[model samples]
Target: MAEFDLIERYFTFEYDFTQASNGSANNKSSQKNKKPKVVKGIGDDCAIFEIPEKYQLVTSTDTLVDGVHFFSDLEPELIAHKALAANVSDLAAMGAKPLAFTLSISLPEVNQDWLKSFSEGLKNASKLFKVPLVGGDTTQGPLNINITAYGSVKKGRLLERNNAEVGDDIWVTGYLGEAAAALELYDKALVQKAALNHSEAELWKALTQPIPPLKFARKLTKLSRCGLDISDGLTADLGHILSKSQCGAKVCVESLPVSEALVNFVGLEQARQYALNGGDDYQLCFTASSKHRNKILNLAERCQINVTRIGKVQDEGLQLNLNGQPFESNRVSWQHFNQ
Candidate 1:
């Protein structure tokens, strides 16, 4: 598609540039103009604002490119949702409440239809998180969208991955292999025909719209020794936690949660592999003292998100215990070189 066609199709908005630029004129002419509560959000040089004291500002930024991160054929709305959700997941790992975000977009041209759908997706996500768009930049280029999200940490509690100690019980929120199963289904055109053991729609939705586990972060802060959001596959991201914590882990492949959708579609072993090595599932992988495991279970029940006891922290270097055997790899996670 042509540039304008693409933008119109993907990012439609009736932005009146004249009105946007003339905001200062209106402000100057107003007789009873109260001071602006915050700086220009959507209509200014930059998102101007002040954050109150007693709150730590948490920020995360991510970029998604058409050919590199996502396929052009995917829904524009889903594209927007995933882009925002992935960034929000970072804030979740830090135990922060999302506050706002800025977007930097580079597009070939304007496609109103695509813009409309994409903006709707962004709006939907913003409403879900109550995070407003403060400001951002737009320019001409191949399709790329970058979002920088901001959140606030309560006085002194923020989960960091470097705090895990030996004997901390490792846990992960939600099932592991469903997303990998969904990806396999997407790649093989194997979405379930019948409702057999699981919902095919759910798998597809999980693949498209990953939920950010920010809501559970507060409960996690109370119980976690250390935490990180799982994006770079279980083995790779967990390796991050281990390296930062100066510890090792023994992951029980049998103990990792696999959803019915994955079991039905991909059987057990392939599902296990996907669960172990699948990247892009934005679940939380955390370590806590053994003393907190029961309390953590109760918290998981209260939050209504699945909590799995996946592994334990050891006193040594990184190692894996899959199917009761040692599994070793110098390489972990998805690398651009492999692709």
Candidate 2:
């Protein structure tokens, strides 16, 4: 199909942001703002976007290539959902409200059914996150999905890796390692979809339809900016926070919250490794003053997500403790080049 014809047939639409559920799927905070303003969208020479006054614009981009990011045999809908969700996860990590997004997709060829499913998947994610798709490009090439997500946050409220302070308690939302475990199972041919048990099914959801904890992150922004989403494993991603904050952490290994699914599949010891080293969890990891412990717990309740206190920020060196003994070793994170 011709590029313009493809977009017109599948991608073009007038989106209604107001009809969307709030960024937090489970609960709505009184302070949650309205959907971001869209000045103009697709079919224009340039898309226009505008947020209300007193908010700073934040943007993030991510690219997914076949074989590297996912198996090419994966469904087009799964591909589309994950391509967009990864970028949205970045926005959540920064504690920003979803504003708009642009997609740049390159497919080897235009298959009608694939395009239909892909567009529907995009629509589903757009509504779920309450973010509009404004403009993007479609081209013919190696199958690739690149997305740039836009967001807005109140001035001086940007979450980042550089603000975690010594004595602050570190917390993470939702279970970790399940997504990575799912990938391992599938890649190793350890299991098949039809044969998946209940716990395995949950792992598959984690691996595929991973949810960004935007609601919990929104609440967290009000309390602190020392936060990020775990795309790489905790040991590696937290290392970025520690390196940037010019501090270190002493994590209690036994405190790392993980789903039973991971343990069932990989056993406790390996599950801990995956929890510490696995990527694609898409859950938020943040730090706040120890005084906010009670408030953080309440916020988690309001968001209807489990938040676990796993460690405390400290000075000098990174340490992992397990049963009163030091654990963790030279950790390696997801790297595109180094690998």
Candidate 3:
């Protein structure tokens, strides 16, 4: 299919953002939700959208390249899903509601089957996240997918990494290390050797189709002052928070939340390594005042997300403690250039 024909067939859709009911399947009960104003979408030279009153636009972009970001032979559908999900994860980190996104993909060759599957996955993710595809470009080149996502957050409620205060309790949403374990066990032949049982398939799913805690993040905007998604592992990503806030932290190694699947497959110590340095979990890590501990816990319960208090912000430098004893490590999170 030609470029325009491919877009018209697979990407084009009519969405009335003016209607509160126009959203993804996961948020059906959010019937009274408000949508941003969109004046023009795909088919135009540029998308024109109006930001809601008192809301600031939040935008983030991510790019995934074949062979580096993922195996070249991986499913096209999974590639599409991960490409968009990574960008949406940034929105979640910012405590923003997704509005729309643009996709720019480069292909080595036109394969109808691959294109069809990729487009379907993208569309499904769009509906699932309640974000519409606004506009994008398709080109002939090495396999590459870049997505720029847009979202909105109310003024003065935006979360930032620099806002963490000393003595604040650090929290993380959801279990970690599963995606890293999945990466370790991804080779089919190594799966059995890694002791990955049938029940642990969710780890693979977590690696492929990570769901950003958007609702939980939104709720956190009101309760927590500093936060970011754990895309680069807690050890390194939390370092970002510390550097920005000009503060230090003491992470309790035993407090790291390791999924049962991971612990069963790799044992506790290895799972801890993954949680600390393996990266790609995409869960949110934030800090709030100790006074709000109960409120944050209640919010987590209401949001149906598991929030764990892993540590506390401090005055000087990052340290890892295991059962009150200092732990030593030379590990760091994933760095695109180095990896």
Candidate 4:
């Protein structure tokens, strides 16, 4: 299919840019309820947006290459979901409300079934995350999906990795290591549908779906400034916050959040390794004052988000403890372009 035809057939939206840009919806209710931020979108050389007068915009782009990011044989729907979710997760780490997103996909070929599933995946995720798909490009090439997500945050509400205080408590939302474990097992054909075990089945699902803590991260904006999404494992990603904050951390090995599926599949020691150095979990790792512990926990419960305190910020360098004794590891998280 031609590029324009492909876009219209699979990615058209109900957004009326003419009405939205002029701020002249048919009625007050329409204008009040669905206040569009886009001044001009799609079908244009450049999409134009009107940022709210009092808010700052946050945007990020994440790309997934065919073999490097996922198995080429994986379903296109999953590929679409993961590509967009990765971008949205970055916005969440900065405590921003998802505004809109654009997709730029390069396809090996225009397979009708694949495009249908892919578009459906993007539409589903766009609704689930409350982010609209405004515009993007689709071209014929090696299969690659790049999504750029835009978001907004009130003034002075943006979270930063450098804001961690020496005495701040380190916390992570949801669990970790399952995605990495799922990848490891899948590559080995140990998670086949025809012969799947319970834990293996759960791990496979984790591999396909990554839910970012968008709402939970928004709630934390008022409570914490030092934060980041854990795409690169707890130890390494936490190093980023500490490095930027010019401090250190003391992480308790036993406290790392490993799901039951991971433990059952790989046992405690291996699970800890994955939790420490595995990647693609996309959970938020953040730091806030110890004084906010109760408040944080209360907020997590209210948000229905599981948050675990795995460590604390310190004065000097990264430290690990196991059973109250000093511990160390040679493992490292996934690094891109290391070659």
Native-to-model Cα distance after best TM-score fit, residue 126 in candidate 3, in Å: 1.0
Q: Write the per-residue lDDT of candidate 2 for residues 204-296, one digit (tens) a residue.
A: 888988889987887688888799999988888899999999999999989999888888888888888888878889998999998899999
lDDT per residue (tens digit) for residues 190-230 in model 1: 33334433466677777778997788876688777478888
lDDT of 1 at 205: 73
After superposing candidate 1 on the true structure, give the runs of residues whose Cα lies further than 4 Å from its correct spot: 1-40, 187-198, 327-332
Candidate 2 residue runs with Cα over 4 Å from true position: 17-36, 187-192, 329-331
TM-score per candidate: 0.83, 0.92, 0.92, 0.92
Each model's RMSD to truth, in Å?
Answer: 6.9, 4.6, 4.5, 3.2
User: Where does candidate 3 have its weakest 10-residue lDDT segment?
Assistant: 189-198
Estimate the overall C-alpha local distance difference test score of candidate 1.
0.75
lDDT of 4 by residue, 112-154 (tens): 9988998898888887897778898888899888889988887
Q: List the residue pairs that clash in candidate 2.
A: none
